[model samples]
Target chain A: MEFIAGKYNYWIYVALMMIGFYAMIAKGNLIKKIIGMNVFQTAVFLFYISIAKVREGTAPILWDRTVLYDNPVPHVLILTAIVVSVSTTAVALALIILIYREFGTMEEDEILRIQKNGSAVPPGKPE
Target chain B: MIDFALLFFLVVCAVAAIQMRDLLSSIMLLGIYSFIMAVVWTRLNAVDVAFTEASVGAGITTILLIAALSRTRRMETKQCVPPANLLIYGTVILLTSAVLLYGTLDMPTYGDPGAPAHSHVAPRYLEKSYEEVGVPNVVTAVLASYRGYDTLGETTVIFGAGICVILLLRRKI
Candidate 1:
């Protein structure tokens, strides 16, 4: 049990990753897949934050006296990453909305059927 | 020991991602695989790389996959074919693994105090960073001052990617 406890954080990250991945792949709903993606990304963020930790270190600021400091490079890089992620998410969500408007349904199979039919019937109409 | 375990987990996630029947599940597994890869980068002491991987690999890439999947259909199990592309994929994997393993042989031993990376430039930065760059963090000095051009390029790449995505998704209006 000690061994398991020692590695508990790592294990949790892995489990969360798996659950997110499973949801993204197994679910037919598009929004559910985006949620899974968000979970997966958060797991990676957790991994980064865990590694940035230092034993008994303070912020990366200097004082009159020298003191141990946790590394701040990772934090800086992550800030940039967050901005990029938000931009990408905005674009992706916009595309998803467009797909819904065109197909009138988010189901992949149904959209493909309409595409294959070459506009014989407008979307969301009875056969 | 932990390193090996993490690597094993990464491999498992990658395999599961490739083998999954549903496209959505495969993309999700790919995100998990990316997260594990970020963990591996952190374990290797590349915290910056780990952060970028977490954000780009897990976050942005996953959203892109979800968007693509929403336009497509869930793949049917009966539509799956035998692994006829196995030989080509196996060869590519073998070549990549070989190249990476060979490159590792030339790398300095992990955490070697005498390595050039820790000796010449890094020590100078650590000792004189405050006086020279007026920054407490040597990494920031290196990134913002010494390698400013590279950082600018990276920012441009992000902007370009955003533009490409907009062009692909947006209508005439």
Candidate 2:
């Protein structure tokens, strides 16, 4: 019981990660894959924030008579990571739009089929 | 009990988001998921991270997804998923999870004061941040002062991503 109680957060996040992973590979739509990737990234953020929590701690701000503060390093690092996540999401959505414009379908299998049959217009040519 | 509830709902949202055939619904569910995750971070005393998650994950990310969905199909097709592909993906995920679980077993317990993460540079920052940076918020101080270059790089990456999106979607080239 103690072991379970102590590490349940990790277990839950791992389960969350597996769900995201399954969606990434099992889902057919390109947008669904990107959603899965976002879920996976946020799960990792949860794990890091979980690690930074200190028992009987408050936020990492200097305040009167506050001794215990949560670790600030992870918070700092995750800020950068969150920015990166947003940037990547933007770029990925742009790519998805381009893929749809070119192949006329967002389904990964269909896109592959289009490419395989050589139906897609070649690069740098008007469709 | 509240943590368990939050986590349970989080997993539910994750599953529902993935399983939803409507891409817009999935995107909304994902936004909700991010909001809940941000709340969890706030409960964990990671206020700064929670704020960022709420802004980026729930706010900006959802908007971008909706914008993208407007340009693409909303419903996923019912084509048969191949068993061979499932098997390969399942094996890879299981192996990776196993390795990660093994690694977690040796990690310090949650909130251990003596954990390597809390013991090292964190202590110095917590102890000296006010004196050195004169900032009440240690997170801001560390992000802006100690890791200024990293934050600058992240800002540049966001700028680059904006440029890429404009270049890709604004023209047919």
Candidate 3:
């Protein structure tokens, strides 16, 4: 339908966000959660870019003659955000690697168990 | 028309994000949500905000997530019992939504020429920004000059976050 097609971008955005959030909360894998977080952030980026568009606006750069300019402020802000995101990602990955080194398995429950017990225990141990 | 549909999609995305079980799929959905938000910003004529949302929200953030995923495990090890604090979470979500909806009720109608925003200092900036700051974009003028101090503070906060993340993740040398 024309109505559906006209607003397809928004629909896609929502679908992606839902998928990411669900993955972050539902999946037990820490790596998968990170992926979900990435997808979530990307959805926001798509939203911001879509807003910057103008039907007939020109680029922010000025010409000798008069011209209607598309907004450039969001572009500048997004650049900064990108840098920050990269730094954050680096840090998050480092922490994840450390977690893996500390625990033989990447499973959350196993890590929790190790944390609670302080040492590996036999499977049948009640305590 | 389109606006109502967009709002509906937003609500649907929020619910699905909360309800989905696969963390990977949820992350992808979050990206989709951000994209929709960008479209909303465009509809509202806030082009600058929309640009920032797209590049940062969709591109960099997604990459970061993938990188993080590579460093961690990919599967849930055990089944987790649902938390007992459901009532508290439900209450919090409800209160926040109510407050947000209430705030929206007092907002100016979309694209109203008589709105306070159009009559304020913004008009002056729109007229004189080129002569005053030599910038073609009024949004940049406002961000870099009118609210330069706030921008500076935001930059500082970002730097601090970077430092904190590094400190937390870096192995002691």
- Count the clashes in each prediction: 5, 0, 51
Which digits, one per residue and each the tens of the lDDT, describe model 1 over residues B1-173?
Answer: 79667766765675566557676787788788778777866664455656667777776777777766565445523232236544554455456445544544554433334545444544454556678889866557756776666567658767876786677566732
Local accuracy of candidate 2 as per-residue lDDT tens digits, B1-173: 89889999999999999998889999999999999999999999999899999999999999999998887778877766788988898898898788878877887887777788988899888988899999999999999999999999999999999999989888673
lDDT of 3: 0.56
Top candidate when judged by TM-score against the true structure? 2
Candidate 2 residue lDDT tens string, A41-66: 88888888988988788899989545
Chain A TM-score vs. truth, each candidate? 0.78, 0.89, 0.78
Please list the residue runs of candidate 1 whose C-alpha ends up more than 4 Å from where it truly belongs after superposition.
Answer: A1-127, B43-48, B76-85, B171-173
Score residue B112 of candidate 2 by CA lDDT. Answer: 78
Instruction: Note the DockQ of each predicted structure.
Output: 0.10, 0.70, 0.18
Ranking by TM-score: 2, 3, 1
* lDDT rank order: 2, 1, 3
Compute the DockQ of candidate 2.
Answer: 0.70
Best by lDDT: 2
Residue range B1-173, candidate 3, lDDT tens digits? 78667756765665555445554554565567657766766665556665666666655565665555455533445555356444554455456445544544554443334545445654565566678888867777766876676578667767876786677666642
lDDT of 1 by residue, A1-127 (tens): 6444334445445555555554455545555555555555555554444444444444444443455444445455554554555455556555665666566655556568879886544354212
What lDDT, from 0 to 1, does candidate 1 have? 0.57
